[model samples]
Target: MLKKVRVQIVTDRFEAKGSLYETPAGKLLPTPLQDMPAKEDIEHMEMTVEASYHDDGDRVCIRYKESELSGMEGSVTSVSFRKSEPALISMLRDGSVKTALVFEPAARHLCVYQTQIMPFEVCIYTRSVKNCIEENGTLEMDYTVELRGAQAEHTAFSMRVLPVFDKPISK
Candidate 1:
């Protein structure tokens, strides 16, 4: 069965304990990454995305207009997400956020990494631990993205999801 879900993502700044630099060396920091003060003005972004979603229990797919702002609104982008560890989904899936992006057309192992905020286009890759909270039949997911290299930007976002269901379509 296919299900409909309402997704709302709101993000502005990334409150980080320290800054991360993505270099040829790898993910690193100037000083000890832990026990540090949170940084400010890391990035500027205020976006609201509303789209149609389909989840087949095992896989989650979403399609929406190409631009949230002014545009022809004729093109749609489809994205799919698969569990990293398929076998232990129920046991270790909660509060775990991994890299997510469109699975086809212009596909890659990770999102097209960018250095600055394009205002209209917010593209950030996140592969980190997620914190989750449950409400009256709703779930909230929170995660962060970091600026890497000299021209990079970052953000921390919270996504609230509410599921909608309909009668199964008869074959």
Candidate 2:
């Protein structure tokens, strides 16, 4: 049987601003500033995660929805996933592995300007699992998200994972 799951995330938002420049012909050229005037603008973010395993017992499907709230308006950022080896099942069942969750950036969408952008390469890994539970034979895992991108500036954000459950409640 499949169990309905909800994961709650709490995090401290940190912000820092600086400048980047490039030299051409031995002359330094300033790049456009990120201009994040409001410190609250980049402070806090939220994400929703839903995952279910296939009935065939080989593949799993997961989705992530992230939104940032600051200023008077809020925006949704990027959403992605990761994949790992099949050993995750043994780790979870035995409870031997303190952290058994492994994820990869399977798909992602980012809001850029007035349009949404889907970058070709966006990957992430599980930084840590804060909590884990098996209730009514259902397994729930919660952790922190660590973002990774091909570029530096684009890869900066962390969100808490809500308890994501695997379907069929594996024994």
Candidate 3:
């Protein structure tokens, strides 16, 4: 069944060669900056938007739009996953900027990124993918991008698909 939903997406990104800080356990620490993607070695974004959610058999899908608040005003995004492949997910964005990205653990996908200037081919290497939508209403992915054959950035992306429950009106 398909129903209206509210989707919250949070993305944390870092340059492949960025960061001079690490945790005591030796893990890279996400940089903190006032503005997003501010060339300060790290970027972060969180957005909530209305969407449609559907689940049938073993497949789950969520579709949403990109508003001006997201800087992708006319774009639409669709994300889907299958229960059998819980470690993989597919995302497609159409409109101003169009692209289809497949996220699978330890795999690389070559995709075309369409822009107003021109279309460029980019390479995406997935480090990890966890789809817990059906179980917990969340999906997470980590991946790196290569632009023009050069490593660019790494992004940790997560989203929650929550049902919108309306309150009853008193007559």
Which 10-residue window of candidate 2 scores lowest in summed lDDT? 90-99
> How many times do residue backbones clash in model 2?
8
RMSD (CA, angstroms), candidate 3: 7.3
TM-score of each: 0.45, 0.28, 0.79
C-alpha displacement of 58 in model 1, angstroms? 3.0
Q: What is the lDDT of residue 111 in candidate 1?
A: 39
How far residue 154's Cα lies from its native spot in candidate 1, in Å, is 1.0
Best by lDDT: 3
lDDT of 1 by residue, 1-171 (tens): 543444555554434443333332344333213423355544444334555555566655554443434132344544444544221111011111222232121111223332233212222334332423122322222223342433333333444554543333344
Candidate 3 ranges beyond 4 A from true positions: 18-40, 149-151, 165-171
Each candidate: what lDDT?
0.36, 0.28, 0.75
Q: In candidate 1, how many Å is residue 44 off?
A: 6.4
Backbone clashes counted, model 3: 0
The better-scoring model by TM-score among 1 and 2 is 1
**Candidate 1: misplaced stretches above 4 Å?**
14-22, 30-50, 66-79, 84-150, 164-171
